[model samples]
Target chain A: MTSDITLILRFLSILGGGAMAGILGSLTGLGGATVLVPLLTLFYGIPIYFATGASLISTIATSAGSASGYTKHKIANIKIGVGLEIATTAGAIVGSLTIVAVHEAHASWIIYVLFGIVLLGSLIPTIQRSSSEEPLKRKPDWTTRIFQLAGEYYDTKLKKKISYEGVRWWLAEIIMFFAGVISGLLGIGSGALKVLGMDWAMNLPMKVTTTTSNFMIGITAATGSSIYWYEGYIQLFIAGATAIGVVIGAYIGSRLLLKITNKNIRWIFFSILSFLGVEMLLEGLDKAKVLVIATTIEEMISIAVAIIMISGLYLKTRRGERAVKAA
Target chain B: MNVPSKQRDIDSITSLILRVGVLSSLSLIIVGVILLFIRGSADGVSISQIASFHSTFNSSYLNPTHIVQGLIAVDPLYFITLGLWVLIFTPITVVFTSMVTFITAGNRLYIAMSLIVLFNLFFAMLAIPSLIHT
Candidate 1:
């Protein structure tokens, strides 16, 4: 009887954790795996392999739940998403296969460090571009024309239609390929990289970038999941709970996203990126024995950095708003 | 300028499929979990045993024959397994439908693009793993 209670409690905890990850993932287009893996492993004491398996399931749930809404609203650009997916899917296959070689080399720490550096580096652009809702218009290039990378969406917050075109399609594709490789190597949805591909390289609006990234994550995750399945990584109870919770959270998050401003969404994304970046960096350092910090201290440092960065950005944005008001 | 009607149709269809797939799988999972709670075990595996962090029993142990047997006997764990299979295939279904949609639209570029992605998915999910095992 006590065992039954314990089981129920564990199930609920997993469900709650999955829901939280789903909300953040759907909101930021990071596919919730970023949050889910850490939460399950650190908080619940689930094994990392099982946590990753559950995280993959949550990613699909978030993508499916939120992408449906985004599609119905015409916020997710299907043409661009499908076109770029060719590179990501191919990259995923390569990355999954490459993991064997990487594990054999015992060089997985490098990937963690590289991933951390990439996340931290991308923050500069995210903060710089936070003030603008849309990118400056540029002349359409051939790649954009050939790929048909332009679309307009009705922005609820703006109460108007926003038409935008993605340029530098080749650059975006290259980035997406790396994104897929990273996803396959790491067993997480590389949503941040996908967002960067579209938002930075392709010059799509944040709203479009996020929703489209969410749309693509499902396909990417689906590719990797089969491998995880065959490897015996998926724990049925954990995955079942996480998938259900993530779907509910993702549904709520997609609704919230439509109502929230792009700047607000960027703030949320920025905070998550900072936290994840520092966590990954510390994890890599600890594993490499380069800087042997205790896990508690490492977490404290990541939280502190995330808090400082988020507050700094908030104050900067407020000051800018005040200046505009005075003007 | 507005989105083309054909494009809109594609979006609606895709969204519908995603919604259906996710919800149906979710329902199946929920039912299975509930059943497990009432039954206290699934397929001779106790709840505690299957729910453990270090549990060795997983998707690897599941096979088509066992899944079919579980479905026939209304095994709770197998229901969950079936639900997972559904969830995993949801996006693959979307990709397939999108390819078909592109074909009907006669959008040559997207048709080729979708076919490439679909093939990649198949290769990664089925071909590569089977080849490696062999």
Candidate 2:
């Protein structure tokens, strides 16, 4: 029998993933996959393999479950999501091979580097309004549109009609290819980079780009994860616990989202991502014998403290901290 | 533009809400039935997700069957089992979506129907694909 504590912890991890997804999702205007994989693997002690598969399943669940919400709200741009998916899916296919190779090699150093890069991609550029995007190289040509791709979602927050022009289509495609390689290699969702590619290269609205990125993630992870599943890297027990947990958590998170302000979610999300980055660097240092302190005990205590504090704050928030978090 | 002066009788709306809620639950059951019929096991249906479903359901030691030989199915027992699941879960899905809809639409019937369609669509996407894959 699964211990009650383990089940609780498992539930907490899933909920935490959903909450963080909501938090970062609104912050970066992207889905939770980018933050989930590393967070699960590094902090929660879920293996990277299982983390990737579960994260992908959760992405499907999160997107599938929430697609109705976004659609009802009319914030998801089907055109943009579908259009960009061509590139993203292609990237995902490439990423599948890459992930298998790296995972098979079991190169710890490379994982550390990828983790740092993703962290850097996620953070380290707060000052820029909307984060400076790269210039679009060339627009997606006829081949892209032939698929009847391209869509638009309304940004209720901005209350402005936003349209997408896949600027620098070539550049974005290139990055997406690399992003796919990274996603495939690292078992990471690559949402952070995918968002950057869209926002910077395509010059799409941030919210639209982020939502579209969520739409794109399932297939990307699916590509890599199928290979991982085939290779027997994925642990079904861990994946199921994580997947079921994530779905419930994500469901709750969405409910809370409609009630809560986006700003509060963003701040909490940024704080968490920053901490994950620091913790990862520390872990790398410890692994390399550059750091003296072991994180096992500290990790447990930190997690416990975070749970206590967050839960306490959640209760307070429920008790009527309805003053909206600032935008 | 003035919002349309739409008023609904409370009783009528309440009945509509109840009806929609029941329909949504039934719709989910239909989906669950379809899914279970396709891929669910004769002995037991496991999640398309490989390991997690069996672990959670099996670990219970309370699974109706002692040993779920294969993936779970929509046999005669499926309804007895899933009906209980929907009995518990449908209300949650309906109520949650109803609450969300109420926040937006003042019309209760609208809220309830919206909830039904919204949730039905959501699960169908997951269930249909899952059923096929499993």
Candidate 3:
């Protein structure tokens, strides 16, 4: 009887946790895997491997749930997403294989540190572009014409048809390969990297980047999942419960997303990115035993850094808004 | 300018495929969880054991044959596993659909692109894994 009660509590908490991850994942197009993994490992004491398996499952759920909505609304550019998958899928293969070597060498901390730095570094471009609704127009180059890297979507918030052409397709592909590698190695969707590739390198609009990144994530996760399945990383009950919860959360998030502005979405993305970035860096350092800071101090420091960065961006955006008004 | 009708068709179909896949998988998972709650176990494995964080009951032990047998026996765990399998395959199905659509639209570039992507997926999901296992 005691065991039964414990089972019920555990099951319910996992379900609830999954729903929260789904909401944030769909809202920001980060696939929630990054958030879900940490939540499960830190709070529930689930093993990192099982947590990652559940994260991958929930990532697929979030992607499918939200991408369907985005596709119906024509916000996700399928053509561009499909074209880019070639690189990401190939990268996933390489990354998955490389993880075996890393695991053998006990060098997983390198990946953790690298991921942390990349997340923090990507924030610079995000903040720089936050003030603008769309990227500056660039002449369509040869790669764009060949890849058909152009699309138009009706922005619900702006209430206008936004047509954008992606440039530097080769650069985006290179970034996507790295994104896939990160996804495969970490077992997270790595949506931030995909968004960076498209938004920063390809010069696509934020909505298109988010939705298309969401669309692309499902395939990427699927690739990683097959390998995880073989490795026996997936705990079925946990994954199922989380996947169901994430779908519910994603549905709610998709509805909320359609009602919000691009700037609002970027703020949400940035806030999550900052927190996760600092946390990952601290985690890597702690694991490597390079930082002797107490866990509490680390947590406090992460919160402090996130607060400072978010407020800094907020103030910058406010000043930019004021300048635009003055002009 | 409006999106080309051909592109619009592809988008709608992709959305439909994803919607159907997710909803069906969700229903299966929900039913499986409900059944597990009522029964308090599956295939003689108690709920506590199966749901435990460190549970050894995972995808590695269950093959397709085992899943089929479990499904035939109406095991709730198998239902959940089946749902996950559906969820995993949904994106692959979408890719296949898009490839066919591209072929019909006579876009040579996209057909080749889609083919390469599809092949990569197969290589990762099937070819390389099976090779490693053997």
Candidate 4:
């Protein structure tokens, strides 16, 4: 338990995984903890309980690092974000309380199953809008005017200032509450759900959806993490390594984001989501004795499914492009 | 024009606070990790033991006073833990700053919303957690 060499190796390996998760998280607007949780649980053989704590702490790290840049650029709508935080922080309290019961009962399979479903479900919207960075234009509603949910940012990709207004503030708040609950229970930033709340329900631009979600995630994660801290879920060495590594990795990812096109990045993000979703589902099923297979075999099956899904996505996009040209 | 310019000032200040809070915490965490490895242990717990997921070191026992005491003793784990706390508190700090920002901007709606967020944060971070644990 006290070996020096083993300790160094563990630190390096966790750091590497956290870094990769950070890059994926920044590109996808899913916090690094989303990918990092699955990696620790499946690949590193860490307990899901401990992996969650590490993931939660690392999410704060990633969010804080990235939120600085997004807020500075004035893309993150502080007014809208704080308005929604009222709901999210309240939901986080409820989630943390619920998890204490779940943890006591040792019903972790439920978490894995839910995580799998959420990831798989989110992929649809990700794929549907992968080609278009512009959000669907919708007229501002009464909630929008009241909440002052409007902003303008210069899009480097479009090379012009784009002004957009968000509608359905109440809808965004409803979604944020659940997003916070998920963050508390799963120890993730739940940034994907936050993005969905704004991008889909509120009719915000993708750039704003992403940056604002990034800004909002820090508060939600913090609300959850304080509870995790009290519940004794955090391991100092593992969580610390993960947080530091993910921060460094997210920094690199934000730099790379300027050069890479969103479409290419979306593909990479979707593939990772598919692979992790299948892995979590199979693992949960196996744990529940619904089916049994060697862990290696499960990993292989997940890889195969990911490859097939990615290829199918590629073909569909290509066909769509062709149809658009042919028309 | 006046409102937009004032808003931008608040935004820039808020950004500076976030950058400092995050970067400093990261550095503290990194240093703490290095100390754990180089020292081969912290507070008599070996690095390998701490690195292991199953290590029985319960951070729940580390209250603010204990954390401060640990810091005095140069405990690597405490340093790392403090860093994590800093990371968590960063957003809460931002909420407070925003409250003040809204107050100065005379945005009554946002001030009320920010007050709710701040209340929730304090209740979660301090009041309820202590009540539950005790």
Ranking by TM-score: 4, 3, 1, 2
Q: Residue B109 in model 3: shift from native, Å? A: 1.0
- Please report, as a value between 0 and 1, the fraction of native contacts recovered by candidate 3: 0.85
Ranking by DockQ: 1, 3, 4, 2
Best by lDDT: 3
Kindly provide the TM-score of model 4 when superposed on the true structure, using C-alpha atoms.
0.95
Candidate 3 wrongly placed segments (more than 4 Å): A103-115, A118-122
lDDT of 1 by residue, B22-122 (tens): 99999989999999999999889889988998898887777634778898898998888888878878888888877887788788999999889999998
Model 4: per-residue lDDT, tens digit, A1-327?
A: 446777778888898999999988877778888899889988988888788888988888888777777778777788788899998888888887788778889888877887777777767767766366677678888987889887887778888777777898888899999988888888888888888888888888887887778778888888878778888888877888798788888888777765677787888888889999999999888887888999899989999999999899889999998988899
TM-score of each: 0.92, 0.57, 0.94, 0.95
Candidate 3, what DockQ? 0.80
Model 3 residue pairs with clashes: none
* Residue-level lDDT tens digits of model 2 in A1-327: 244344445545555664555445434534555577667767677655566655654454444444444434544444344334445545655565566566667645456546645664564322222322222334656534543224444445556454444555556667776766676666555667677776766666555555556545544554444445445544433443344444444556656655554446545755565556555655655555666576686466445544654465456554544444331
Encode model 3's per-residue lDDT on A255-294: one tens digit a residue: 9989977677778777777777787788778878898688
For B41-92, candidate 3 gives per-residue lDDT tens digits of: 8988888788888998888876755778878888988888888889999998
Give me the displacement of residue A293 in model 1, in angstroms: 3.4
Off by over 4 Å in 2: A1-23, A124-127, A131-155, A158-166, A252-266, A288-293, A296-327, B1-69, B72-134
Backbone clash total for model 2 is: 27
